[model samples]
Target chain A: MSAVAAALPLADDALVLSHRLAEWLGHAPELEEELALANISLDLLGQARACYALLGDEDALAYRREEREFRNLQLVEQPNGDFAHTITRQLFFSVWQELLFGRVTGTGPPAAVAAKAVKETAYHRDHAEQWTLRLGDGTEESHRRTQRAVDALWRYTGELFQPLEGLDIAMEPLRRDWRARIGDILARATLTMPEGPDADAWSAGAGRQGVHTESFGRMLAEMQHLHRSHPGAVW
Target chain B: MISLAELGVLRDVRLLDGGRTAEVELTPTYTGCPALEAMAEDIRRALHTADPRLARVSVRTVLSPPWSTDDITEEGRRKLAAAGIAPPRRPGPARGPVPVALAIRCPRCGSTDTELISRFSSTACKALRRCRTCREPFDHVKEV
Candidate 1:
């Protein structure tokens, strides 16, 4: 796999998730939370831009890409359900991201990117972990909602460990560490670990193959609207 | 506009071609910092204002050796505190004449009894905190 091929998966993941979080700007639970979500969104968007810069023509790659062309994990493409659901999704993805960035080897562009990203991902993971503790151990309503979010999003977690084509990463060890860390967090939060197969004949997968879930199309439509409407528009 | 140099993102400046052109290197405090573009533009405008004869001014973003809150200058920390914002505690040893503070002190009351309200705040570079003694909330430039 070429450099572009390796970088695309990471870039697309950041871009899609950034857009999802950006959707929460005016809709978050409170003002501080809104700012937090937006800042995280900006951070992801910046990471995506940095990766896309290595690929050539960041705008064309991002705004012109079709649903079937994006290499992001399906977990990121799922619609944000609620504050509880959003936090759970963040918890799942940020943990995976921190591990992936830390383990990616070599001094290539990807490694350089990962080196910088590992620190940011640590903070993102902490934000999610703190919220997980709050929602899982809070009142009856929060606990129920967070547990529901966890169960709903469990199957989507499997695709994260699937190795990208050019990136030299060992999938099994990454998966093991992910499971151990996630299990510890859930246990402390007083939430039960979901028992479904992370990857199997039943789990959702194939996002790496350019396939995506239903809600992704709507997201792409919104993301591409401004660029498509004016081919050469710039400010 | 005011704190760019104090923030320490400005890494270097060079004048070339008999001073007709200027090149500026900047290291971002965070990979996703939105202020980079504005800072670049500000530098260009400021350069032209200072030297109308300068034909070109280029600002480049450098990502390697990623920035830390420790890079914030001593003057920057003082300005932040004066503005009711807490400066970041250095994650490493003091390397300069000024000593680093070990506590995340309340900029309002100079009390060390502040609790983090959120790990993030109005910007990506800051964390929100509330002082237990003064009962006032403020932004703290979080250590990276």
Candidate 2:
């Protein structure tokens, strides 16, 4: 894979996550959660935009491309299952993101973009952990649901760490370090990791190769509809 | 309007506009536009482009009374629209111009019948709203 192959997926992950979080904007159970989710979504969108900007600023390159152009991990494109599912995804992804960002921020990538994303992901990780703990222990139903969500999403977690073509070589060691850090946090939280076929280790190749689950098609249909329909539509 | 003289940004004791450099008070587009740096840079550029001689100009970033939809002026709305921006959701009821409630009109669909789906949009400065009629998501302009 080329830099674009590696980069689009990174940007797609953030952008998709941003879209899902955007869904929970006013609809969150509470004002604080509402604000928090919105904030998280905003951060992710910012990260995605930065990633997109770096990859290709051309509207066509970013939004007008076909479904295969997106290279985000399946975990990100996964539908926002129930709230539990969504939170589960967040818990798992944020842990990884936080960890990756923590290490990357130390010294890797461009100082401006990477540093900014690193700071934002730190908050995302914190926010996700706090919610996981809350939902994991708050009530019987919430706890059970979140735990189940953990179990379901666990299968996809491995993909987050599997090295891919064109991945930032300098960031490889940090990515490994991130896995360990994420592992420690999950253990302390007493959260159960999911089990299933490795979403990231697809024999056909993972999302990094632009091979995605069915959900990506639908996501692209909706996301790309307007831009495709009215070429160059802005504002 | 607080006097720049109080902030010591004024060059002379004169109270007239020309007596001092143009005051540039910066407000985030919504709540947390993250594009603040870009916006700030834009303002500086706009100022410089307008008049390079305007030195000692003061640009203040005030977060107080955090931006609300209410702050959107008629002129701002037009500029936002012309810029292809979905203007801020009108303050008041979430639905279409409640006439009494003052909700924003949707850019995706001109329908005033809109409901705020989220108080936060992709950016803090904008809130997410859905047009009841179009079911399309739109950005509500924040007061800032």
Candidate 3:
């Protein structure tokens, strides 16, 4: 596979997650929350845009491609279940992003860019952890719902750790180092790190290999609607 | 006939073709007031009468420097007072090179009897505050 194909899935994952986050805009129960969530979503979108821009032109890499041709995981594309679900859902992703961004800060980008993003993602992880604790330990109803969210999302968590083509080659040792750090954080949060049924001792999966979920077609549809509808149109 | 500073612009502000309206993107004094839309509309109407090309004004939400209480401009402070928020007392600047905690004053009943209700109140940017003596609820822009 080409190096671009190998690098595609992680950027794709970031893009899809950015979309789910964008859905929360203007709809948060409180106005402060609306603004805050918007900020977080915009940041993620910015990161995803950067990742895709590296692969190709920002607009084309994001919008010009067909659906099945893209390769984001299903976990990010999953619906936002509820408030507790959203927080719990982020627990699964933020833990991963925190490690990913932190390690990148140590190595990638120019010193200035990497330094700024590391601080920013740290705050994102902080917010997620705060809400996770709140919903996890609040009232009985809150606790139960939050747990259920984790349980439902757990099955899909397996794919996050699945190795992409050349990730081991391209990502340096950050992935290995990240697994250890993530384990400690999750354990501290009193959340068990469950694995897929085929966990351990297995070769990684193929998101970067251009494999994707059925729903990605629809998501790509909505995301690229304007671009596809008005071919060669400038905004 | 406005200075670039009055336009709240800094250096070579591009006037794009699809300019939506003539509006100042004043940073909010606090977050999550239900009145901001009304306030933006009022600014829009004011601008519209002055220049028909200024069809509508909108608030541009910016979070850099994180919208601190310190950002409330002198003119903005006056507007807030006219709008009925008793401004917090600005402490003397780092006297002897040490920062002192500033105090918030109650706009209603001009008393120093004020306390924070919740740090995360009506909005993330504002804290819910109550005047102890008068028991009036007021929003405090956070010291970001």
Candidate 4:
């Protein structure tokens, strides 16, 4: 795939996830959690903007794209289930992103962006890790809920390790590092790893090829509603 | 009108063609910052006000050598502190394999006994921190 093609998937991943996090604005558990989630969402949105700007008008690309045209991973598009579910999703995605961006930092067109973004991803990963550990080891109910989230989201983790077309970074090392890091965090959090078939046959994914989960369309419609309704409306 | 330089986004300014035109370079603190366009427009307006004979004004956003908290000037830091926002600590060496805990002083009380409540705050570049001595919650600029 071309550079733009490769970048699109990465961009879409951030865009979709950013929206999902933004959904938590007023609904987070506490005031601090509310701001934290918004900040993370903004960071992801920034990354998406930087990548989209590489192609053309960032606003047009974000608002005008069809559902099938988006190349985000299915993991990011999955509905935010609960606090534990969101944290699980954040942990999985941020760990992969930290590792992926770490490799891409000094490489090519994305090097500068990756260099700046990796630091943010590191903080994101740390935030998720801290929460995972706290909730997992906190109470019996908290531990059970956190574990349930871990198992439910495990299936989606494999798609993150899959190789993108135009990116030259080695996937094997990233996968290895991701597994090692996540395994350690899970162990510390007193959470068990989900056991099942690998990402290829068992897990449901295919977003990189423009295929998405059923919920993605609904989320996209909501996200694009205002932009589509007003056409050229500006604040 | 707040100048881009005071906002800590302006990087460089140059007068070209024997002062007939002006060029300004700016870097956004965060990639998604909405103020970028407004800042550029502000620069253009300021230049026009300074010299009516100026034929052209160019504003560019530079991304390489990315913007960091370190770029915030001393004056800007004072302004931020006065506004009840803690300025970022001086950026140190590149992060190592192991995470290091850096002390964040309370902007209100100047106490080193501050605890990080969250790595993120209301904005992309700040963290939520609390001072143990003053018992006050404040915003600390994240060292980026």
lDDT of each: 0.88, 0.62, 0.58, 0.84
Quote the lDDT for A62 in model 3: 85
Which lDDT tens digits does candidate 1 get at residues A125-223?
Answer: 999999999889999999999999999999888899888888878989999999999999999999999998765474345689887888999999999
| After superposition, candidate 4 runs with Cα above 4 Å error | A105-108, A198-205, B1-8, B92-100
Residue A233 alpha-carbon offset, candidate 2, angstroms: 2.2
Best-to-worst TM-score order: 1, 4, 2, 3
Query: Model 3's DockQ?
Result: 0.06
- In every candidate, what fraction of the native interface contacts is reproduced? 0.55, 0.09, 0.00, 0.62
lDDT for A47 in candidate 4 is: 88
| Angstrom error at residue A22, model 1 | 1.1
lDDT of 3 at B87: 48
Candidate 4 or 2, higher lDDT: 4
The DockQ ranking, best first, is: 4, 1, 2, 3
List, residue by residue over A43-91, the lDDT tens digit for candidate 2: 6776676566656674666577776767777788788877778877887
State residue B94's C-alpha deviation in candidate 2, in Å: 48
lDDT of 3 by residue, B27-85 (tens): 33222233445655665566668666655555553323223345455665555555556
Q: Evaluated with TM-score, which candidate comes out highest?
A: 1
TM-score on alpha carbons, each prediction: 0.93, 0.61, 0.56, 0.91
lDDT of 4 by residue, B1-144 (tens): 324566567889899999998899988777666678888898899889989999999998776677777777788888888888888887668899997777878888989999988887877778888999999999987877
In order, what DockQ does each candidate have?
0.63, 0.07, 0.06, 0.66
lDDT: worst 10-residue window of model 3 chain B:
B6-15
